[model samples]
Target: MRGDSWTESYLRSDIMRESVIYQAILEEGELSAKLTSIPRLLVLGLTREQIAQALDLEIEQVPQVIEGQN
Candidate 1:
């Protein structure tokens, strides 16, 4: 009975893995140290100023680290 229910659910397309784009967005907070800020910015909706404010860093430095990501 349990196996039949699972097979029916799979065939019905109600349970599926997340899309790659959504997975990428979910992984925004997990970039490596070298790619941290920039990749995070690309993956999410936060602006440089907002990120800088949240990080307690200089606003000018945000551009340097997050360049070409826009």
Candidate 2:
């Protein structure tokens, strides 16, 4: 197959989604999004414990995320 066709086939949404690299990227993006939301949740009156539980993050990780945002 030509390079363009091969690349296109490999990058198709369904095929890309099945790749281990793609899955890892997706998970990282999800975790980033969750971490990014922590400060907002705090401003809305959620404690570190509540945010950790609601976001399914470790309690220790909550403070770390907050610190990183500073």
Q: Encode model 1's per-residue lDDT on 6-69: one tens digit a residue.
A: 8998866643444656677666644344346655764698887777776666778678776645
lDDT by residue (1-70, candidate 2, tens digit) is 6999978876896575678787898899999999999999999999999999999999999999888878
lDDT of 2: 0.90
lDDT of each: 0.65, 0.90
Question: Which candidate number maximizes lDDT?
Answer: 2
lDDT of 1 at 9: 84
Candidate 1 segments whose C-alpha is farther than 4 A from its true place = 1-35, 68-70
Q: What's the TM for model 1?
A: 0.40
Candidate 2 least-lDDT 10 residues: 13-22
